[model samples]
Target chain A: MQKSTQAGFWKKNQRALAPWFFMAPGIIMFLVYVIYPIFQSIGISFYEWDGLGPKTYVGLQNYRDLLDDDSFYTSLKNNVIWLVLYLLAIPAGLAVALFLNQTVAGIRLYKSLFFFPFVISQVVVGLIFTWFYAPGFGILPHVINFFTGTPTAILADDKYATYGVIAAGLWPQTAYCMILYLTGLNNISPDQVEAARMDNAKGWSMLWHIIIPQLRPATFIALVVTVIGALRSFDLISVMTVGGPFGSTRVLSYFMYEQSLSEYGTAMGYGAAIAVVLFAIMLVFISLFIVRMLSQERNA
Target chain B: MRSLKALAGLALGVSLFATAAVAGEIVLNSDQSDPAPKKAMEELIADFQKANPGITVKWNNFDHEGYKSAIRNFLTADAPDVAAWYAGNRMAPFVKAGLFEDVSDVWKDNGLDDALKSASASMTIDGKKWGVPYTYYQWGIYYNKDVYKKAGVTEPKNWAEFVANCEKFKAAGVDCLTTGDKGGWPAAGIFDYINMRTNGYEFHMDLTAGKVKWTDPKVKATFAEWAKVVPYMSANATAIDWQDAAALMAQGKAANYVMGNFAVDTFKKGGMTNDNLGFMIFPEITAGIPRAEEAPTDTFHIPSGAKNKADARKFLAFVASADAQTKMNATLGQLPVNNKATAADDPFIKTGFTELSSAYALAQFFDRDAPADMAKAGMDGFQEFITHPENIDAILERLDKVAAKVYK
Candidate 1:
């Protein structure tokens, strides 16, 4: 009887509470996992910690040290390069999606095959590229030698090391963007495209005016993910170069790892400071994205 | 109603099991994920269990690289009763933080002071023994005897003869030296040995410990000497790993590899026999400087947060025994820390034992000897020096800047 009364009350309030019930789990999760760590890392950035020892409060000293650090600047520059080059995945992905959009025999298999690099783990991708770029043994050097008459080890030269790692990162990222664009293309309103076709609109003109206008939602998501992916590119660098051939391949993420988590010794505070700097940079893009999203919502 | 009762019963069972699981057992974390070392660890645990039948030992094994990062979390959180770590400065930080337990009683009770005499100094901090070392191995130049013979050059005794032999190998169309710095530590090994040879072991220790600046003239001399030999080394070495470079040596394309004795196993696996593979001390660079070798020692420690201290101590004492060490290192293809252990019949082992026994001092390699931040910067500098030898001053200056911040 008591349980039935409770159920009755719940049913009475269900209209008002159902949406909140649905959002509660997601909100709690975001708060705990995502939102909490950002503030926590910021808090830790003010202290010097070795991850094992007692944390000592050091005020803004970590930030001051980071300002003086040359490697921090190098990592920041590489991150900018990564952010710029990583966006290339979007256009390349859209192009591939367009090329494979048509119906044909084994089209499903071809699509799956095209999506293969994304399915493989980044660690494996890094290893494959490492093997590919290894001089005197790897196939890449052979190919380069065949063309240029001199075998070049892409990963060994400091000038090319970060670019080499970036290229490896692009392989999987491009595949991911391709999949997103394929989905967006599948969901496109056929009436508009058909009407454009009847009006003699086709190729680049149709793509730029009609297809792209409808794919703005997918493009926004792709840009957001790509930017985040570029910032968080630690695995490939670690697996391939270990920030070496002289720390030339270090990104901010990899630099943070080397400072705190690596086998050498821990400087958790310094690592957190690097993380905070990276977060600040990411916040700029994120805030711009949010503002644009808000304006779009208002228009809608 | 029936399902609710069953759920309650299941919860009750799980709670009982959880209590049973935590009552009395020693949790050991180790990085003996490799085949031979894994087997050796199993045998050691079995022996320990046989000796202490009352206690339960729960072994948690991780891969070498993963364990390094995982250790920091486990030490302060859910620390194992026993954990594998490296000796010297590597363990010093943990000891200073009071994260590692002082197992001085274990050392005293088992007379490990005499047994593990060689590693005792490394395991000690603040005049207390914080860990027990079980195994260590030698690092030196491993050369192809056939390549040396083909070039008509013998084992070089001093830097001059070594350089001349390198020239001979170069003249004969063979790469003179081979090393891999893709992972960074392999190149750091070269730096460690060269620095030791250039300024003697004391200066090398002081430098790694950050008592001396990287821009010191003594450090510059080591880089200068390394620069002279860079042209003789294998081209594009940074692209290959240590195993791949050893492959070049095994194929007789490269004459020598400045590596640990472990490279012998890889050489053997690559089909180089005892007859062709030769181990030699790095030739003397600074005359009258006592020769010091890099011999990284692997150790086990009791974490301060360990739940089962008694069982952990027993494990350490048993591991420190000469009998346990001999069998462990035999499977590990490494040298036992116990001086009283029976010597292996292997030629390389014999050579390493003799060489290490006569050495004036031992360094735990560059990465192990130096703090991690400095080691990372130092190794990066070393790798940079290899490709751009002219950038020594700039690299050293950067390293000094890092050292100033890190060592402080």
Candidate 2:
């Protein structure tokens, strides 16, 4: 009787419990690596620690200092610039995908050439851009010198350093988005396009009313990745400028690492506070993305 | 019966751990991953082992970045008997955290107090020696003689002559000075020399120790002096690396570089030979301020948690000796920290030896002398000043704000 009852309970609830069993590894990993560290960083921000010496509790002092910190403001300004400028990748990517979508001789070769930047490591991209803008010897400065009679080392000027790094970041990002859109273009329903063409819809009208709506899923993924990429734009800055020309190119991610983990950095509490602020900024967008996806799921 | 057997095994393990340190064996941990430093380390180990045959060294080598993280974690958990680190304020955190052992007795017994006299102050903290400095390298103006000839200028003898030479170089279309502060610390080298020369070494010591305010008149005076040469510096210096600046000097594109002895190899690699490469002490600013020089030191320390403290002390004393340092630095291509030790017969090394020996004080460079936070902030401020000399007051104010927090 006891065996049968146990068997009956398993039979009844296994359907509900089976998915959780399948998700156990991922869920546990998320809880440990993601959720726990977020709280741990938040807790650490309330202390004065150098990762070597004893930690002293200083209750929001790190945040208070950030308010007065000029570098913090500079990093924040650069981050906003990155977010706004980085969105250009999506539309730019769409244009490229559309341009390359048509069947032609060696179309795959052209598509791969467009995809080359993203295929290479971000470090390589940064190095290429660094050489491209290097002072005196770089091609861009030489060209600028020829045209305007003033040689411009784009990475060196504080006014232009962030934009220069953003341009390097955009190369890979645009390619990534292009691949997404290309795949989306392939999956567009032929019947719907045929119907739209039958009504004499074409060009911008066809793209706006017919193609883009079909590309919504691709657009969503591109938006999410681009936003995250912009937020976590550390490698290019590290390789090209190192938050230099008087800290003009520093974003919050690089700032956090500089404060806490770089060769000269040891301010654990301050770095943690910066991390918390970055997380809060990310949380707003992440929540919006989650909400939109959930509404769409419900509609589907 | 099985549980009892397990208990017996656990007891045996505990007893073995207790006796391990006393078994005539010592473990040495270091991050001398470069070819020269690694070979020098191997030779030093062999020599130490030969001298003390009864004792053995178990060496665990690590790469540079990994060792920095390892030393901190390993010190508190399973530290080696001897570990490689740096000197001056760079080692202060470890000393303060009780991560490093106080080796005052090692200094006294080895007569290192007299032998390594130039580095004595840097190795000491709270009236106790924390480590043994083995090697250091000098910093001065490393100029291209060919560039100077091309510009029809001679090496300057004093501050006025230096400024005059800068004008001559400007006329010749050569950058008077070149430096890249992208990694940030290179600018601090320029700041240190100017500050030390303008006021004195004591002022630099106090300022870096945070006893002096950044906005003080004396600091402004230093900045004022530095402002004269800012125009002559590379306009794009804030974007490049020190190596790039060195290349500028090597290629005859720039007239001078304020750099360390290590850059000699890089210059040589760039096809600059000894005859065309010139070294000179920075010209005097305030005439009577005792001539201080920068020579950053690298050292070895024993962790407080080290198991074989006796062997570690022996290792420290051995490294501190003139013979060991001379031989080791010969391979490492750097200056021996010991006053009695002979530097390599290379012309630059010979000049560096004289420069350091004659100095009234030896600063361990700005980044090493100042706390890491202040060093980084001060260097960033220096970089800004290099680009925008007009922002001196703003930079100083920002530095003062950071100093207020850091010093507190």
Best by lDDT: 2
Deviation (Å) of B94 in candidate 2: 0.8
> What is the per-residue lDDT of model 1 for residues A1-300, given as tens digits with 9 covering 90 to 100?
999999999999999999999999999999999999999999999999888778999999999999998888889999999999999999999989988999999999999999999999999999999999998779998999999998889999989989999999999999899999999999999999999999999888999999999998999999999999999999999999888788788899999988888876489999999999998998999999999999999999
Q: After superposition, how far is residue B228 of candidate 1 from its true place, in Å?
A: 1.3
Per-residue lDDT over A107-126 for candidate 2, one digit per residue giving the tens place of the 0 to 100 score: 99999999999999999999
Candidate 1 lDDT, B1-408, residue by residue in tens: 699789987876665455333545789999998888899999999888888888778999998989998888778656788999999888877888889998999999999899888888888888899999999899999999999899999999898888888888999999888887777788898888888999999999999899998899999999888887899988777767889998999999999888997778899999999898999998999899999998999999999978788888988998999999999888888898899996577998888888888899988988888987788888888888888888989999999899888888
lDDT of 2 by residue, B123-146 (tens): 999999999999999999999999
Sorted into a CAPRI-style docking class, model 1 comes out as medium
Candidate 1 shows a clash count of 1
- For all the predictions, what are the DockQ values? 0.66, 0.62
